[model samples]
Target: MMKAKQRIIILLLAGLLVLTAASCSSQKAADPATETLKLGVLSLEDILPMVVANEKGYFAEEGLTVELIPFQSTVESQSAIQSGDIDGMMNDMVVAALLKESGTDLKVTSVTLEATDERRRFAIVVSPDSDIKTVADLKGRELGISFNSIIEYTTDEMLVAAGVSPEEVNKTAIPKIPVRLEMLINNNIEAANLPDPLITFAEFNGCKTIIDDRGRSIS
Candidate 1:
């Protein structure tokens, strides 16, 4: 009798297992196929992880189809996402905030990178031969930057941190980074905010860094 009862219990448990499997199968059948996310990014070292994940098939393994769209500049990438040319982008938080303020319906899902001593991402640089050695010296000087963007925001913060008011510094709108770097090199601009690779390149070409947002959380 006890053996018969045990068998009955085992059968009931198996029935429950079958029901759960059927429910899951029906749910999966009702759901749509995995989605493909079109994400935009600039050609920067900070985006290396995304590149690696795509190369390694990690996104595929997770049931996500990712398409990485590369743009020459952050503004271009942001515009792509805003215009629905792409679904999302890797950009500065300040830019994202400005986008939201300007009525772009978007959300910041994650922070991919942070400022650190080992990974200096942004800096204010000047010609090595220039007399502007400190942030305070940047006062009343023309700093080349893409106005109303993250570069300007960071420059303002860095300058204020060094006891110089943003209003005291003259900002020149130079949207193209290469142009800004060239202007800095040729003394066409007293100073300019630059991101990695460019900052390193400028340094190699006799540019002096005034301040860097290292060990600080910009986003």
Candidate 2:
């Protein structure tokens, strides 16, 4: 059996050990890794939840300091990521797939949105005065489209479904939807392909939707 003083010394040593353990835990809690994390967002609408997360301090509660950077295009946002100017981005799957195919350092960490209707985000149209009433009527008529994306695939599908071969239409490449819209408005092209909200805008300006992929599958 130990003497009473020895017993007290053992108790004190045990207390010291407990205090040391508590100190270590406190240091860990205060470490820089516990600090807020930086993140990037493509646009306000691209991921509204991210905007809400930042505005409502949800990320702050999670120890994150997400910096939302709005870019004109997904390509611009992806470029920012590649250059390390931003940590990550909420962008289109095509951009992500391209990056992965090329073995880019960036990986799509999460998918915020999956495209369902091709026309949910895009639409095919003709001018009100134009005789082109159906997709079949698009033969020899100008059709505008962006290159090498879901747009191309969906447009090709639209053409095929309308009994029009892809070769039948005068395919024009106007990469920007706004430019395509301008062409449509100016009658430079009998038909123009554009994405939303340009689709909505074009329709508002009297462009007719001859074919829509709203309920159609692009996959």
Candidate 3:
């Protein structure tokens, strides 16, 4: 098995082939500007390889131009791709399925982050004053999540993996990460599903982590 960093580098280079494939479409002139690949991305660890490649002139050396467009959310990222404002964007399997279901032609070029014992990507957390001390305690309470998103999937996965059946769970569509975090911290929502940084912050703020996807890669 390749190390995590090595796998990321290889996958990122592999992803550039998508740009090359698109470069052949409807172009009459050799315009360097038009040939530039536009990739819509969120500010995540996955963007690191693209940043390094751009900064070190790797794309230019390889006769390719790349533009990395930052997006605030997946909704915006998908909107950019669908409107042709961007050629591609970093996305997950859940979003890919949703895109296909919506009739969008999508291709998954690479896997940026993989599951590892040291990496805790997401968690189901409860409010500081919440009576929910475990995933089983979440049966009748609301779990905040962004609707039809990875967060929602993570919540469901966390529940099922922890032996809580779908009929025993309750989900509330909070739709925004910041809002979800705030609601969970302030006791507005009994529990909320979130990724790291926010998950660590919630722990620091006295919110309890009922479970997290660390070893079990359910998401």
> How many clashing pairs in candidate 1?
0
The TM-score obtained by model 2 is 0.64
Better of 1 and 3 by lDDT: 3
Please give, for residues 119-201, the per-residue lDDT of candidate 3 as tens digits: 87788999999988889998878888776777777778878888998567778877656777888888888898877778888
Name the better of 2 and 3 by lDDT.
3
Worst 10-residue lDDT window for candidate 3 reads 15-24
Off by over 4 Å in 2: 1-46, 112-119, 127-130, 186-188
Off by over 4 Å in 1: 1-36, 117-119, 216-219
**RMSD after CA superposition, every candidate:** 13.8, 16.5, 4.5
What TM value does model 1 have?
0.73
- For each candidate, the alpha-carbon lDDT, in order, equals 0.72, 0.61, 0.74
- The lDDT of model 3 is 0.74
Q: Would you list the rank order by lDDT, best first?
A: 3, 1, 2
What's each prediction's TM-score?
0.73, 0.64, 0.76
